[model samples]
Target chain A: MRIRVATPSGHYRTPTYIQGKVGVIEAVHGAFRNPETLAYGGDGRPKQTLYLVRFDQTHIWAHAEPVPFCQNDRLLIDIYEHWLEPAPEE
Target chain B: MPGVHDRGGWPDVGPINKAEHELSFWEKRTDALLVLLSSADRRVIRVDELRRAIESLPPEAYETMGYYERWISAIETLLIEKNVLTKAEIDRKAEQIVEQRTIETTE
Candidate 1:
């Protein structure tokens, strides 16, 4: 399903590895962002755009050549919907 | 002007309330830095990208630039503690991914 990711403007801990990259919606974990931190002023409110995105494994490997066992590692992108798109068929 | 006791006597008026002025200056700087840091962490852009954005600001702002240094350091520390960006690398691993895409498309 097409989903939107949260993209808040600020200093965040999202790995540079996932920045600006698109991923498939492996599963939707619900919306959330760290609200207590200075980023959210401790408000604890989940950012509306935040979603757990699973990168297409084949695409991720093609780009990030993972070490054998590490291939299972998932990319949790804190993104806004504008950054995502439908995965091109293989 | 007049020496302390020469004119009327009190402590001479002093040079523009340096302490208060400095405090206000730093306070504003700190607030600005916080806004930028928050934006960067919210996934708007990478930290280095944010730094470049800050550098683009006017030179006068640099007078209080120490505030930026402190804020960046604090944010980096927090990110490290949370296992986000590491000291070893600043850019994301996205480049490698992009490269792979190029190879696949060509083949």
Candidate 2:
């Protein structure tokens, strides 16, 4: 249940750190108005789903230097559904 | 360029400043203003609007301004965009507030 935070241009709520990173969907926060449209004063009629995604510390720095990571260590991020894509089951 | 507010993984940007500094008096006022603006019977502004305003700031100001200053600028920007207040009026009112503060300090 990994969310695909695609790096697209324009008014976006997805933080750059979590963009393109894979994480497990820990929670579904229901639907809310799209912030990207709301930023421009337009009504975010079609609400988007927000999810709390959990990632391992090592998953975040897989490309960077290898750091000692504990199995219990995790990072959580709230992301909208539009920016997500399901990943292959682990 | 990416939104100014999205600074994650930007190598040049220094470490996250974690020092806990008490909110200044004016900062507290800004916080209160934000609450009233969004929590009032009629929602005048949304948090997304504020973030957009903060991201819309000039790169230098966006990068250098303090957290609360950023919030102030965002609030002002949103106010202007919504036609709730003009830039000139905000400028004048800011000047008056500063002048009044200085007088109160000296008196």
Candidate 3:
């Protein structure tokens, strides 16, 4: 899955740097209240499914430094459902 | 551009401060207030609202404030936004506190 690339105004949990990044679902963290809606005093109805996503450190930082990729290097984060979509066919 | 609160991958951010320190008196109070307000019994505020308020701060304030300072500032903003407290009321109370402190110092 790829994190949605967006810059909409308002409260969101997805960090900017991770937007548009591709990662694999490492684990499902169960449905949880949407923080974006909750931030504005709205009841987070229809909870979102959260997942632990893992991204290759080299792939994530590819646009910048060319630090050699090590299999041990991985970045993992919990992402909500709305912020993700199936990665485009490679 | 990302909001001021999102500084995860910034290039020039200074070294991470790993030093730990004892909590100040006011900082402990701020933490306790957060727990009390967000607890199930009170439900006065949510953690999400706190993060939103903190993220919404001006870039200057976001950069200048310490961790607990930011939390207290955000909590105050939420209180005002939720109509639990008025800005004027908070301001007057702050002034009263300052006056009391001044009198104590003079004495």
Candidate 4:
């Protein structure tokens, strides 16, 4: 799956680095309140599903050297469902 | 582009500082203030609101301010935005505190 590359003009949990990057879903974290609305005094209705996505460190950073933990090293982040979609076959 | 707070993979930033240090008195108070404001009983402020306020900070302040300093700054912004406090009120109160401290030092 790939994270959606959307630059919303308000509060969002997805970091900029992970946006538009391809990653594998490691776990499903269930739905939770939408922070975007909750941040602005709105009731967090209709929770969004969350997932633990894993990405290769090298894929994330051009200069990310496979140091002490080389290829096995991976970065895992929790992303909401709205920020993710199916990635095309590699 | 992501905000300045999104510095996940920037190069040449140096090693991560994992060293833990004791929280200063004001820092501890800031933490307690957040907890109290966000508590279910009060619901005065939410953690999400704080993060939003912190992210809204200008790049210079975001880059230079210490952690708790950012938190307090965000809390102040949110408080003003929510109408719980006004910029003038806070400014006047801060000036009074500073004046009191100066008087105490001289005494």
Candidate 5:
């Protein structure tokens, strides 16, 4: 799954580092109230699916200063379903 | 400016300090206060509200204050915003607490 890290003119939950980054959905943690709306005191009903998304350390820091990567290098982030979309087939 | 709490991937972010600290008594109390305030009985505030409140902080304060202070700041902000407590009341109570502590020290 590819998460959209687009510049939303306002507050957002998706971290910038993973924006436009491709990752694998490791697990789906079921529907959760949307923090985006809840943050503003709105009832975040119609819960959204939460997934444990995994990104390769190398993939996330690819553009940054070259750093070392290991075989087990992986970062797992909890992300809402709305933030994700089908990754373009490689 | 992006919310300072919105720290994700920035080229300049320092390495994550993994050191653990033995929490002080007040820190533990503050943590408990947050849980109590958010609990069902009180429901004085919600988790998301606290997050928004923390992010509502001045970027400098958000960046400079320790995590517990951030929680304290947010708790204070929400209490006042929700009309559960006035700023003056908090100030006076805090002063009173400090004064009592001073007296206790002298005794």
Candidate 6:
């Protein structure tokens, strides 16, 4: 799956280092759009988009899996092209 | 030749305890950790470097220094979130590292 990564608007925890990088979809963890503003204690229906992207190790390395933290068991990340390969023809 | 006798009275001595030794030590450790974390290939940091950095700290320092944990956690989070290592793979690797460390210390 081909996806474009961009800085999400509003309050987000994604690091700024991966603002604009293209990454291949390694796996579709699942669809999760949570509008529950539990942290902010607000009723605002916020759109939370999450995806797990396989990034290039050469360009960025911080939370590279092989380590675990929180529900981040499934990390949502932005990857670069160098780490991606063209999907095989169906 | 005459250097020994040339000295006047005694040289002035400064207070040794004037410096914040603990803070300074923490600053140095944090700086070193940040440098390692900032690298594009942080995961590749040699085991020696990691061990040295961790060892340089005082035992109580680890608990007091939340930033250190944050920094390391951030690095790991980035890698997993980016999918550099899958959840399962990362768990396995971390377990292996722990096991290796345990064995090394035991012997």
Best by DockQ: 3
Off by over 4 Å in 3: A68-71
Which 10 consecutive positions of candidate 1 chain B have the poorest summed lDDT?
B1-10
Residue A27, candidate 4: Cα error in Å is: 1.1
Q: Across all candidates, what is each one's fraction of true contacts kept?
A: 0.00, 0.62, 0.81, 0.72, 0.50, 0.00
**Candidate 3 lDDT by residue in tens digits, A1-90:** 999999758888888889999999999999998999999999997799999999988778888766567866999999999999999998
Q: Which pairs, if any, clash in model 5?
A: none
Q: Local error of candidate 6 at B104, Å? A: 2.6
Ranked by lDDT, top first: 3, 4, 5, 2, 1, 6
* Candidate 1, A5-85: lDDT as tens digits: 335344333433454445766555565544324343344344535556776445444654344645566654555444456
lDDT at B27, model 5 = 88
lDDT of 6 by residue, A47-67 (tens): 444556865543343445342
lDDT value for candidate 1? 0.48
Model 5, runs deviating above 4 Å:
A8-11, B13-19, B99-107
Each candidate: RMSD to true structure?
27.0, 3.0, 1.5, 2.1, 2.5, 23.6
In model 2, the runs with Cα more than 4 Å from the true position are: A88-90, B12-18, B95-107
Report the TM-score of the second chain of model 2 against its true counterpart: 0.81
TM-score of chain B of each: 0.29, 0.81, 0.90, 0.90, 0.90, 0.38
Tell me how each candidate scores on DockQ against the true complex: 0.01, 0.53, 0.84, 0.74, 0.48, 0.01
- Best-performing candidate as measured by lDDT: 3
- Model 4 chain B scores worst on lDDT over the 10 consecutive residues at B3-12
Model 4 lDDT tens row, B6-98:
777655788778999999999999999999999999999999899889989998999999999999999999999999999999999999999
Which residue pairs overlap in candidate 4's backbone? none
> What digit string (tens of lDDT, one per residue) describes model 5 on residues B36-104?
998989878888888888888888888889989999889999889889999999999999999999999
Model 1 docking category: incorrect
Q: What docking tier does model 4 reach? A: medium
Worst 10 residues of 3 chain B by lDDT: B7-16
Residues B59-87, model 2: lDDT tens digits:
89988899889998889888988999999
